[model samples]
Target chain A: MKNIWTIAKREYDNYFASPLAYVIAAGLLFLLGGIFLIILQGSIQQAIFGGGTPVDIGFINQWFYYLLLWTVPALTMRLISDENRTGTLELLLTAPVRDFELVIGKWLGSFLYILSVIGVSFIFAIVANYLAEPGIDQVKMMSSYLGLILIAGALLALGTGISALFNNQIAAFFVTLALFIVLWLLIGIPASFFPSNPAIGDVFRYLQIGNHYESTFNAGVLYLSDVIYFLSLIAIGLFTGVTAVDSRRWR
Target chain B: MIRVTDLTKDYGPRRALHSLSFEARQGEIIGFLGPNGAGKTTTMRILTGYMPPTSGEAIVAGYNVMEESIEVRKRVGYLPETVPLYNEMVVQDFLKFMAELRHIPNPEESVADALNMVGMTERAKGYIGNLSKGMRQRIGLAQALIHRPEVLILDEPSIGLDPGQVVELRKIIREIGRERTVLLSTHILSEAQQICDRVIIINKGKIVVEDTPENLQARLVGGERVVLRVRGDAAELSAKIEQVKGVQRLKSNPDGSLEFEYLPGHDVRPEVAKIITNGGYEMLEMKTLSLSLEDIFLELTKEQVVTPKKKRRL
Candidate 1:
């Protein structure tokens, strides 16, 4: 556990040790702020004219989540790829730390960075709270944040695994971006392709990140299945990550 | 102490280490000498548990490298050929992290102790990227020493250093090897001859010879040699050199030098010097050319190339 934290702390500190943190923070804040203002104008006009809710909750979730698909790949792409490229992976692997510790520690480092980036997006939420006529749904907002965190964990895990697959961080970033884009595009396609067969239909729908979050958590009901689904995705991603790292031991 | 028995490794169709067996006892510095592709790094990687052997076994500090890897890793400190380090980290911060990774109890003391041992205490606050290659290598040694492992495995530790830095790092390595067992691999035979208590020379993934540097040199070239530079005619000097007692063979070099190979158990230098002057050849330089580890390395590895018809001695 100490070794894991030690690794995580160094990895986390590395983010700030370069200009990467500032770049990521600035991009997320700038983009989120622009989207926030547009949403604010739309919601304000609706509130004044038709007695609508203060913020368009659905639009915010969709836009913020779409930004995440790219922002995450940019952040997590270097987690393992940098180590491999610089030969530090040899140092880390030969240390006394276990395989799981290394995988978890790097994922933890990226997870914290992602959470911070996600944290910056909350400036819009705080601003909306003061301006909303009848404040936004707090429980629903919390659920959406929870959903985002869970899915972000899943995405970072996938990124960590993909990072392990390549020595070049650019290759890792582009590959991860392509993967997330494909998965996001396939989210709603299953419903159009498959008729109402609950077993196979639910399988495809549950596999999609947008399906679970948009249908359940974004609407504020924390269904057990949805939570389980996200957890399982996290597990699969990390399991694949551990396998990729451990393969080095054999060679 | 470490022991390897019949350790072998193969990368697809190519063999890297072929039935290699060697040992280093307590306080012994064993030099793993070989050409670049001669399995020196492969053997170290297997011994340090970076990669498992395809067959056979390696035991380090009494723990098996394959079955008890974590135990072996805890007892060993490795400085890889590349000297891998985090360029973003401060020297002290990096050492602290390594200490924590190794679970040292007194982290601050250990870090300071390692820094002082490598003479890098003054540079602890500096980032690794800011340090010179020599300083970074010293910090690399410091990180390896942070935990005070029982065994030290350094692969090509002197590579990419200035000659002055090479001498400095060799001094540091000698100091560290006083108490712990140290194993280092290098293609430079002089580096091994300078510091190693025992030398293992390998070629084509096979151990060709293993002995002390002096003993290996003696075994490979039993005859004594002397090279002389004279101002007079080469043929006349070669004739005079030929007449010296115990002279087995005399060859005249193209650039007016004389090479003499003499019988063993003989002091031929004084006799050759006297004979050259008596012939009125005005000897400018006369030096006994004692065989070296480099000579033995070339002879043994060269033998491997000429015998294509011979079967590999498995």
Candidate 2:
């Protein structure tokens, strides 16, 4: 555990020492802030005209979760790949740290950084409380934030795992981005397309992470099964990372 | 502190280490002398627990490298051929990070001590990327020593350094080897002779010879050579020199010089000098040549190459 923390602290400091973390955070905040302004204007206009329900800025939480599919890979792509490129992987391998500890530490470092970026987006929620009627739904907002954190954890783990398999940061980035995009697009496949084999379509839907996020966590409902689903994904991703790193010795 | 038995490593069909074996006791400096692609780095990596051998047993600091890797790692300090350092990190912070990884009790003091040991205390705050190659190599050495392990494995530790740095680095290594076992590899034979208490010369993944530097020199050099240059026709001088009692072989050079080889204890220079002066040719130079470490290395490896070829012909 101490070894894991030592690695995690160094990795976290590394993220901030470079411009990658700041660039991604600033870019996401700028784009999300624009969306928040549009939602705020729509809510004000609706309140004056009394045409429809008030727009809660909390609705933008889905965008935050979805954007992570793209940004998480960018955050985690250099975790192990850069180490391999710089030959530091050998140093780390020869250190008195376990493979699992290294992988978990790297993922945890990115998770903390992404969490902070998500935390900064809370300004949008505070703005909604003052600018919109039927402002932010506190319970629902909390659940949405929880969902975003869980999704970020899962994506970062998967990205770290993919990063371990590659020596080039660009290769790790594109592969992880492609995998995450495919997982996200799985939600669009309709069960009706598989009339004879509905179970296959059902399995696909069950595998799509958004299905659980949208149905349970996004609606302010807490379910152990949904939490377990994300945790299982995290476990699988970390296991893959550990295996890839350990294979270096054999090679 | 280090022991290996029948270590073998194969990358696909190419064998890297072919059942090679050696040992190093505590407080001794062992130099692994080999040419390129001779598996020196492979052996060091295996000893440091960075990788496992295909078929072998290695016990480092009383722990099996394959089974108790973490234990081995805790007791070993390894400096690879290419120093692995984080470019963006400050030297002190990088050392501190390594100290933390080693789980040192006081990272601050350890980092300072390491920096001082490598004479990089003033550059501790400088970023590693901005440092010169020599400075970076020193930093690499400092990080390896931060943990103060029982054994140190350095691979070509003086590859790119200037002459001054090489001397200083060798001095530091010799000091470190006083209480800890140090195993270093180099292609430079003189380096092995200067620093190694015992040198193991390997070629083609096999041990060619292993002995003290002086012993290897005394064993391989069976005869003495002398070069005599005179202001006269070399063909005439060669014929006279060959007639000397102890002269085994003589060859004339293009530069009006004759080289004479004789038994180890024989002094043929006086006889050759008499012959040269009797011909009324002014003797310009006469000097005996001593065999260098280079000749010993070539003789040993050359013999190995010949034996393999002869076996293949059969």
Candidate 3:
């Protein structure tokens, strides 16, 4: 356990040393800034031109979640694949550390990096709270943040698992991005194909990450099922990654 | 200390190691000398518990490598063929990280001691990317030594190093061997000759020879021989040389020289010289014959020429 933390710390430091971490943070912040500005502009236009009600203007809070579907690949791409490309996998394997420690350390490191990106996204949240007229729904806002964390954890876990299976970082990035997209919109493909089939739609909705996020967590109606789905996704993804790292012994 | 008995490894039917066995007693630097793909790395990997052998057993520091791999890993330090380092880390930081990974108590002191051993205390804060290749290799050695392991396994530690660095690295390895058993692999025969207490020559994944460098060098040429260049008739010199005591065989060369193969524990050159002087032959040159390790290495690993299959005419 001590070795695992040490590995995680080293991995985190490696990320800090690289510009990619800063780039990912800056990109997420910039995307949220744009979203924050649009929400502020809409609020201003409603106050000046129409004196409209702001109760339904909940679009800005969810834009960042949508953006997360794309930006996460950059953060998790190099987790294990870079180790493979750099031949450091050999060094890590030969060390006294076990397979689980290495996999967990890498996953934890990427998770922390994702947290930093989310931390940057908080800047917009802070600004919107101060500036919005009717004010952001703190409950909905809290749950959305929780939802984002769950989604980020799930995406990072899946990304780390896929990263372990590839030697090339680019391939890891694309495969993870595609998988996240599939999970995020999993129900769409099945629903469009079997529009009238209620059972298939229910099954696809259950499998779709968006169903748990957009309907319950994103809408601030946090459900036990939503928590279980994301947690299970995280657990299953990490297990797959651990298995991949363990298989390296035979390879 | 490390011991292996009939270790065999196969990768999808292609055997990487073939029943290889060797031992390194405490404080002995046993050099693993072999050409590329001779399973030197594979054997070291197995001993270090990087992977288990398909058959047989390996014991390192009194722990079975297959059963007590964690303990074996804790006691043995390994440097792989390529010194894989996190290039983003500073030297001191990397060593400290490795010490912590090895679960060494008092990481600061171990890191300091390892850096001091490699003479890198001054450059501890320097980035690994900025360091020279030789320096990085030393840093790799430091990480291996950080935990004060009982046995050190270095695979081609001096490869790609300059001649001066190779000598310096060998000296470091020799110093390391004084306290811990060192099993290092290298294709450089001279390095082994100069550094190892005993050398194991592996060829085609088999132990071709295992002995001290001096003995291997001596065994090839057998007993002793001298190359004597003389200006004389071949028959007269041959007749007198055959009469010399302890002289085993004589072969006359086209350059009017004689190669004398004498019995072991004897030097009949003086008697033969006297015989030549009495025969009124002027001695142009006389030199003792000693085969180098290179000669023996080539002799052991020399491949047999295989005839090509004939083309069938349709």
Candidate 4:
């Protein structure tokens, strides 16, 4: 545990010291803020003219979900790939710490960096509340943040696992992006095509991390099943990452 | 203490190490001498537990490398050929982090001691990336020494250093060798001769020879070879020198000097001096050529001869 923290602290500090962290943070904040303002303004004009809510609750949740799918990869692209490229992976692997500790340490480091980006996006949530006449539901707003955290956590884990599989950062990034799109977006299409087979549909839906994410964020309800789904994905992703590193030692 | 028995490593079809076996007793500074691509780094990696050997076992401090890797890692400090460092970390921060990774009991003291030992205490706050290569190498050494392990395995530790830094590093290694078993690999024969108590020369992944520097030189001293400078016709001197019974080979140099390779147990210099004087030639100077470690290394590893299986026979 101490070694894990030591590794995590160094990784976290490295993020702040490098330019990638600032670039990702600034990019995510600007994109999220711009979209939020556009949605809120369009919705306000509709409400005053009595045309109903222009920005549907479902659409807002979907936007946050899709935003996370892109952001997670950016945050985790360097988690293991950079270490291997710079030769620090050998240093970490040969240390007295276990493989599990290294995986968890790097995962937590990526999570914290992603969390900072999410934290910056909260300014847009605040602007939405202030612009609305009746104000937004604080419960739903908080639930949306929770959902974003869960999605980022699971996606970051997946990205970390993929990063450990390759030595090139760009290759890891592209592979992770492809995996995320296939599992999260393409699964939904397959599920619709095979609606008659409930088991196949269920499998596709289970693979779509966003499917469970929407239930918690759109309805503003935190269910134990949704929590378990995200946690289990994270655990499996981390387990796979550690196994990849262990296999690399032998190779 | 370290023991490797018939260690071998294969990267698919290409073999990196082949049936290597040796032992390093406690408090002995052993130099792993080999040319480039001689499997020095591969053997160090296996001993450090960074990678496992294909079909052999290594025991470090009583812990089996394959069965008790964690224990082996805990007791062994390793520095790879390329020093692995986080560029963003300051020297002190990096050393402290390494201490914690090695599970040292008091990381703060360990970091301080390591920095002091490597003479980097003043630059502890400087970022690793901004430092020069020699300083970075020192930081790498400091990290390896942070845990105060019982054994130190260094692969080309003094590589890329200027002469001054190399001397400083050699001094540090010699000081550290008093307490811990130090196994360093290098192609520089002089560095090994200066600091290593015993040298193990490897060629093509096999131990070609192992002995103390003095013993290795003495073993290779089979004949008395001398270069004699005389003011006369070199051909005439060579013919007269060949007339001596113990003079095995004589070569007349283009610069009017005769070189002699006398047989073992023979000192024909006095007889040659008498001949040169009797022939009215000036016997200007004659000196015996001493065998250097480089000569011993070249003699042992340049050919593929079967070394006689005698323990310290010299």
TM-score of every candidate relative to the true structure: 0.89, 0.92, 0.88, 0.88
Per-residue lDDT tens digits of candidate 2, residues B157-215? 99889999999999999999999999999988899999999999988889888898988
Q: How many Å off is the CA of A145 in candidate 1?
A: 0.7
Which should have the higher lDDT, number 2 or number 3? 2
Model 1 over residues B195-306: C-alpha lDDT tens digits?
Answer: 9999998998998888988787777677777777889788866776677688866876666677777767887888877877777878788777666676677777885555
User: lDDT (0-100) at residue B212 of candidate 4?
Assistant: 91
Q: How do these models rank on lDDT, best leading?
A: 2, 1, 4, 3
- Candidate 4 chain A: 10-residue stretch with minimal lDDT: A50-59
What does candidate 1's lDDT look like per residue over A65-182, in tens digits?
8778888888888888888889888787778988888888998887887787778777677777667766577788889888988888888888888888888999999999988887
* lDDT (tens digit, per residue) of candidate 3 on A103-189: 888888888877777776666666666565555667777788888889888888888888888888899899988988888776467
> For model 4, what is the error of residue B224's alpha carbon versus the real structure, in angstroms, after optimal superposition?
4.5
Q: Give the better candidate number (3 or 4) by DockQ.
A: 4
Chain A TM-score values, per prediction? 0.90, 0.91, 0.89, 0.87
Best by lDDT: 2
Cand. 4 TM to true fold: 0.88
Model 1, residue A11: displacement in angstroms? 1.4
- Candidate 4 residue A117 Cα shift, in angstroms, is 2.3
Q: After superposing candidate 3, which stretches have Cα over 4 Å from the reference? A: A45-61, B218-221, B228-263, B266-284, B304-314
Considering only chain B, what TM-score does candidate 2 achieve? 0.88
Q: Is the docking of candidate 1 incorrect, acceptable, medium or high quality?
A: medium
